[model samples]
Target: MSTALPSAVLGAAAHQARITLVRKYTSAAGVSTVVVSLAVLVLLWFVRDVQLGAAQVGAGGYIFSGFLAFGVIAAAVLGVAGELQAEREDGTLLRAKAVPHGMTGHLVAKLLAAPVDALVPVLPALVGAALLLPDSMPQDVASWVLLVLVFGLGVLTMLPWGAVLGSVFRTMIGLAWAMMSMYALAALSGVFYPVGGWPAPLQWVAQLSPLYWIGVAVRSVLLPEGAAAAEIGGEFRLELALVVLLAWAVAGLFIAPVLLRRMARRQSGSAVQAARERVLAKGY
Candidate 1:
């Protein structure tokens, strides 16, 4: 019985992942978003020579790192939120709630699929940087390993919060506001420029966010040792960054399941019907 349950859960998760990927890639809006994201990434790569006054090197490495981190974080948060909201409206979540350990299977599917979903948008940028700016790419096996670790930690740090946001925000407007907040944080987090150059208060606020730490970790892996001079405090405080990311991951792990269960419990036929009506009325 124990083995059967585990097998069933894995099977369900795989099935869910296949469905999510098909729906995401085959949709017109999804294709458009991917194209736009690819364009922006290429644009940034071309402009990487731009430099800040306090930086020791051109912004190329930072731009690459920032792009990588931003992609993963945004995928974990915004991507999950938008998809979950859609699923709820379309009765997908309600259907999952009906099956044995369905929500668990769904969550497992997200855990398996979100990273792949995140990568589709980022792979082009990764390839572009490697071919066009080889110096910024990780040259050693150790650095490559570190890059993987940082990326995984970043996903862990943000994925649960994405679930929370999706569960809490029932309306598109609410989700839009949440997305705007993420953009605001990205601006402050030095995705496009050096955080050290920001005002002290803004710098502090940026540091408080997981996005900034993810950027820090990425930069540490991809940039040369001397490149640390351009970072806040003129050094990479990787230990601090690790702690911050771990803290977020731990907190999110605790909070996300509770909120998800609560959200799942509230799912009903009437709620799904109302959500569909609202979506239809909005012409979305």
Candidate 2:
């Protein structure tokens, strides 16, 4: 009995170690921070010539808000996808499964660390935008606070889908495809314009994208009242943004875990070996 107890304790410790390892590995990539910086530079350059016509710098604020929200979501998804795919290909995933709590710990760590990793990138951009874009700054502290809360929740909601995709497609190419799709969806969802401005059919499609609601919620707070902000049909639809973001969060929470578990179960010997070779070849 004494021996058995020691063995169990050691097993538990090992499991915890695996989880910690996964979290550390994932956090080291820092992709979101890189992306956010790139985005800020792009935004500054793109809008350099276009002066807002009585819209206040608030228009710039609106645009940055959308970019911030999108950046969070993109970071979470890309982070998970890249980390998991790399692990899957390198046989680290298989090694993880050998430990009693390895997979569970790793997954929990990934979920926990994702938001933190995303925020590292977003916070700086927010500070810079607020300082430099005087006209587009939030009207007051309350609006800024609300925007942060809503956008943070939005990113949390989207993370599970990213995890699912990472687990399901264990290849760099597959991850790239997922990212491309995410960008395309963002475009359709009105990250750049009001979703209502799209053609009726396109509007219907845009509504399905989380970007639409996120943009709406952001615009509602930042744009001045009666600003003729782009509209969908005969109605202004900012009210739907919060609801949609919350809905996506709830849905992703339920769906992502199940999908990840299924992918875990499907991991095979050949796939694992192939993945290992790929990772080693790339020097990851």
Which candidate number maximizes lDDT? 1
Indicate the TM-score of model 1.
0.90
What lDDT score is found at residue 220 in candidate 2?
63
For model 1, the superposed segments whose C-alpha errors exceed 4 Å read 1-5, 26-33, 48-56
lDDT of each: 0.83, 0.68
TM-score of 2: 0.77
Query: Model 1, 42: alpha-carbon shift in Å?
Result: 4.0
Residues 69-152, model 1: lDDT tens digits: 888878899999888888888999999999888988998899888888777787877887787668889998988888888888
User: Over 4 Å off in model 2, which ranges?
Assistant: 1-32, 35-49, 52-59, 226-228, 233-239, 268-270, 278-284
Clashes of 1: 0
Candidate 2, 190-256: lDDT as tens digits: 7766655467898888877777776666666655654444557534465566777788888888888
